[model samples]
Target: MTVESPAGPSTGTSTGRRWHVLGAWLLADALALTGTRLAAVALPWLALTTTGSPTAAGVVAFAELAPLVVAKVLSGPAIDHLGARRVAVGCDAASASTVAAIPALHHLDALSFPALLVLVAATGALRGPADAARHSLVPVLAESTRQPMERVTGLASTVERTSSLVGAALAAGLVALVGAADALAVNAAGLALAAVVLGLGARSVGRGVPADDDPHSYLVRLRAGWQFLRRDPVILALTVMIAFTNLLDVAFTAVLLPVWAVETGSGVGAVGLLLAVMAATSVVGSLVAAAWADRMPRFAVYVVAFVVCGLPRFAVLAWSDVTSAPVVVMAVAGLASGFLNPVVGAVFFERIPRHLVGRVGAMSTAVAWGLMPFGGLVGSALLALLDLRAALLVAGVLYLVTTLAPVVDRRFRAMDRVPVEVS
Candidate 1:
């Protein structure tokens, strides 16, 4: 399966080795995402069940993400210096052990709120590195093929998005059929599987262990990545855009939607349907991207992706949309989300040197995702003054306004034109 690079001109020979790498990567992503999602899905349940307090459950959410921002900023260079693969394996193993402990502690009736917070925070820290490592692996997996590499990266999203969807569903089923403790155990097992897949099978597929650059000490390298981000206006602007959108999206998903459902009598079934529509459609969008990569302006496509994602909220306010109609709307948002994935991939790697990729990537995601905690809390606050409909409309207008940010920034516009040489 020889595939061309997305860059231009030459084709990369897809050897049997590359396929093996691809399979291992996909499996690793599936297992890791499954574990993460499972734990996330069951978290609120655990908090509520154990504490029987809504405020306490909310505190759990805040604690979970609080370390993410700091950890991501701090872990970048360590990932690059230490090796993304090694970091991923260790992170997965640690996460698996921590999650497994949740059940063990519960069995003894010894679990406390602080203990839960520590475990969640540890998992969050691991998540940032795991994301960077797996993402950094994409280019290595399809080393010879540019177009195929891009496609592989795009396909990786499919694995993540799908596994995430399934993991959530699986968590619910496990919780119902078994218990929260058992669901957590399953999450731990999934993490163990992820570690095993990456540790044992990846290299057989054409993956390379990056040479020990030993460039700078971990902290020095971390500072260098930050310095790079500071200098690169395009990356910085896009990062800001992503960070802000993350905040808004989290707000909508966690706080606004639930309130709307309760007010409108949509019920849990509709909520599930709404989320499914979003997830399923995002998959469709990514497929479209793979099918039509030849036709899009990569940067413009990324911008449009954000626009589509933010558009539906305005639709909700204007149309008084219910869950049924919102599914169709959310699907479009999902598709845009799909289209957006590759574009981010394109830009994120385009700016950084290969050696710095893990640190930079991990740091970037952590910083971007760190904004969500605020978004959720803000959404909770906003719901007090306005209905979900009004709050969503505000979010939509704000998102639309932000879309121009990347377009107006000269550095981002010029990124698509920069020529690069990849071996």
Candidate 2:
């Protein structure tokens, strides 16, 4: 299906060539995400098992996510200045070096807790910019390939979910076999490979910087992006809603679920199993969203997806003693979760100018992810204060209420309007 390019003009690349370019970007993204996913599981597990303290695990998680959010907020100008492909390559290289050090130090018996935190922090800082760089390239890729933004977004989401499924399974096996610290080496390798892929494949893609050059101060440029986001009510609404949801999600994934697994005498392998099923179903959801998103009302699909994605998983985990029930609940949630990004992506790409995409996209995502660093710590503390069921119940109820805001509030219906192009 043909759709207007977010950039207002297509690159005129042949259909086959466009698909090839899109394919390369997708594969590189999958590899990069796989590496991060591996590190995600290994890092927290290392902290939890080695220190035997949930608080310590939360601290490690905070170290990573906090730096990442800061980096993402500040990296917009740098992406525009250095170019997306270049930034992606540099960031991945830096991540690989930092992540590899964890195992290297451990093998030398030189890995102190503080040193590990420093290394993980470095990785997080690199990850934020790298992720921004990759996301900034999405609109460009879709325009170049002449694909609909919704379908491209859906495809990208699918690739991410698929990689997470594979990456989680791989991480679980590696952790079980070679131990968590050693599993980090796989992350390092994946990052290195992703760097190589982008360097080679996206060499000819134009840098994301705008045509009108400005010598404005960094803060001024940053403000310009912020101003644009503030002016757009839809962007602001989505950002607020997502920030809340992401906070709950991180809390659940990073701490609560794992803690529950331990309490139930279910191994890390079971944790992996639950996550894998969710990711796999998410892939299906993304594909379906891609095929039919155009036919559905964006607002309706978005709200319904969030309704399914939220509440039930938490409720099931909290109340159900049966393992299979929670798994099924998560699977259903994942399926709904898959449709969300495509709608958001379509709107996001359509509204922002092609030139400002790097700066604006970075700022936007940083805002959405702003609260995530505290999620792990808060989740751990809640487990300490409240029983598991009560904590989950609180999360579930809060999620249901907050996630429904977009549906209940009249302002969110603006999401259905055609995007007004920013100058």
Candidate 3:
């Protein structure tokens, strides 16, 4: 059962230590993502309540996400040069400080709208690198453990779903008890703890490819990643498809869902509750993917999952008046969505060389998220021109069309190819 290791030959000691690293990585990811999910709920609500305008809320979202995308794009060289573990630890610490400032300034009554935007933007910038570094650790960790990428990615997705479930519930309770401003303190703590845990445990892993022998400039390395990405038809297609889908997703979560809650008189609690339901069901789907995804046809599974998750949830929200109906639809959608990352991640990691993973992965992720900064603006603009239901239906149709790309394009069939080990 021996598999090639990226760092070196797989020894018994290294194999055992890989489990430790994997556990630490997953735990840190959970903590950091939980904090992020809380902020995701708190920040929009804070903006909405404070400004009393959806446009203002959209502006606040744009302030954060625009810097985030830029930071992610620029972070590729630093990650390849400095190592993923170091970058992750440093960025997480910075993110904690920035996030803490939001609550501190709000409490002091010094948090102007502009000041709030500044803090949010700083947090987003730091978080982009931290997230990219963390994601780049996955393939190396997978190789070390001698596990299929699908299993490790599935486990990661399960952790993500569980964290979302916990984070959403905690956000509801915190917002109820302390309001949105103070609930952010919990997020700060989580980020700080993640920094500590990962810094301590993943020190020996994630060193990335050493550059001592290579004579390439940083820009050259960065350009290499971009060139490879553009040349690969499969990855290129995935990036374009995911970019559009991510834009739609951000719109749904950040703007559309919040507006729906408010308009339905459901309050912030219901928003948190619905998100929790989706995350909870998603955990089940992730578990199933972790266990059986390697045996399945990736392209078929991906298509089916996308079909199930993409348009139905929006349709339910748009058409249904019953509280229970949307919840049920969201649960089903979440379950389908859980299989997505594992399938996509395995294909992505399989194609990229170990040496280029940091730069390539970051570039791909940056492109995939490039349009997200405008997602809130798009949702807000739709709301201005059309009613809430009309906006939802419009977005849903767009989503359906976007998700159909894999079926229409032959390149995506490469996802089902047997992956050659990329050392």
Tell me each candidate's TM-score: 0.85, 0.95, 0.96
Tell me how far the alpha carbon of residue 100 in candidate 1 is from the true structure, in angstroms, after superposition.
2.5
lDDT of each: 0.68, 0.84, 0.88
Error of 2 at 235 (Å): 0.4
For candidate 2, the TM-score is: 0.95
Q: Which candidate's lDDT is highest?
A: 3
lDDT of 3 by residue, 81-126 (tens): 6778889899999999999998899889999999999999999999
lDDT of 1 by residue, 299-387 (tens): 77877788887857555733664665787787778778887776677666766666667667777777778787676576666665676
Could you tell me the C-alpha RMSD of candidate 3 in Å? 2.7
Displacement of residue 362 (Cα, Å) in model 1 is 1.9
lDDT of 3 at 416: 86
Q: How many clashing pairs per prediction, in order?
A: 9, 0, 0
Q: Alpha-carbon error at 93 in model 3, in Å?
A: 0.5
Q: Which has the better lDDT: candidate 1, or candidate 3? A: 3
lDDT of 3: 0.88
Residue-level lDDT of model 2, residues 324-391, one tens digit each, is 89889889988999999889988888888765787889999998989888888988888889999998
Residues forming the 10-long window of minimal summed lDDT in candidate 1: 1-10
- Looking at model 1, the pairs that clash are 4-147, 5-146, 5-147, 6-146, 6-147, 17-205, 20-205, 21-205, 76-359
